[model samples]
Target: MMLHTALNWRYATKRMNGRRVPDATLERILDAAHLAPSSYGLQPYSIVVVDTPELRERCQPAMYHQPQVVEGSHLLVFATWESIGNAEVDQLMALIAEERGVEPASLESYRHTIAETVARLSTPEARHQWAARQAYLAMGMVLTAAAMERVDATPMEGFDPAALDEVLGLPERGLRSAVVVTLGYRDLETDWLAGLKKVRWPRDRVIVRAE
Candidate 1:
């Protein structure tokens, strides 16, 4: 059943009909992103859901005028935290301590370790890069979950990150756009890519044995 479920899913979406995806389905996709694993449990990113037609129209230019930006039912903009500062680390450590019922004082050693690690990457650009990697993990999880829910999705990296950040006002929140995924039902009639075969390296060629 698991194999069948996965095999039935493919990234063949190019154009999406204007039909809207149900809110519940979208919620499930977002929930999957929330549950995705991240380094140090920092969760250094947030998912921005763009469902309104007006907003999508505005975002189209940022996405290289891609039709899917406005045609899809929803556009999920993955934004990464701008910087990893002491405040952020402290908050995460505090939450971990509280959630695990460990003494806050016991986590002082961990706090110092994490603080020093973040301190080493002092520039905003470096921190953003780290956060972007975490966002990609969430993006992958969202795509897989969409497939499981029988929804079509397109993982796009062709957008102008700076423009998207400006349009979405992410920079104001100390976040930067890392990636975008369009979600909806695929338009089989107009999408040529839908009919093309998916190409990938064979498992034998891609996977290497440790021995």
Candidate 2:
């Protein structure tokens, strides 16, 4: 019920008051996203934290002059790898082994199975599409976390990915910008949507029982 209230409290804030998010609150929100589940536990996306005013200035044009891009306290750019290569898979394998206190070789069979299946889509276009989807999962986690923190966040997709990539120097890292979210406090006095009620489909219409 508390979660539901939080969800209701959240809205796509169109304007922010340019207040910085407290470090502790920001950390908890980020931790919630880090704990989000990803495909094969690979966690292929990297969240780029942008808080500098100068950096946000550069990002403004890339985001098509969205006020939130410059007004928000922080901008989170969720960038995903272009593709999952052997080196990438190996890194995850090593981490998993260390985290689970097991030999890396123990995960060899599972690793190969994933590679053989996903390697077919190793092409740039295919991987971008696949990686972008996983990024959305993290986005969902971010939204929920933001709500829990009583912070305002706007899930944004209105931007040029190629332009943002160039600005962020993502191509050098073999990463491409997928999605973004802005975090801050909404302008209560000026925001028109502040007093409106949230509307959604009823549960019976959206939730179907397979049985």
Q: What lDDT score belongs to each candidate, Candidate 1 first?
A: 0.88, 0.88
**How many angstroms is residue 31 displaced in model 2 relative to the true structure, after the best TM-score fit?**
0.7
Q: Which portions of model 2 show Cα errors greater than 4 Å?
A: none
TM-scores, one per candidate: 0.94, 0.95
lDDT of 1 by residue, 1-211 (tens): 8745754566758898988989999999899999999877889888888999999999999999988888898999988887687999999988988899998899998888888888888888888888889899888789888888888999999999999889989988988888899998889999989888778799788998988
**Distance from true location, Cα of 74 in model 1, Å:** 1.1
Superposed by TM-score, candidate 2 places the C-alpha of residue 126 at a distance from the truth, in angstroms, of 1.6
Which residue pairs collide, candidate 1? none
Measured on C-alpha atoms, candidate 2 has an lDDT of 0.88
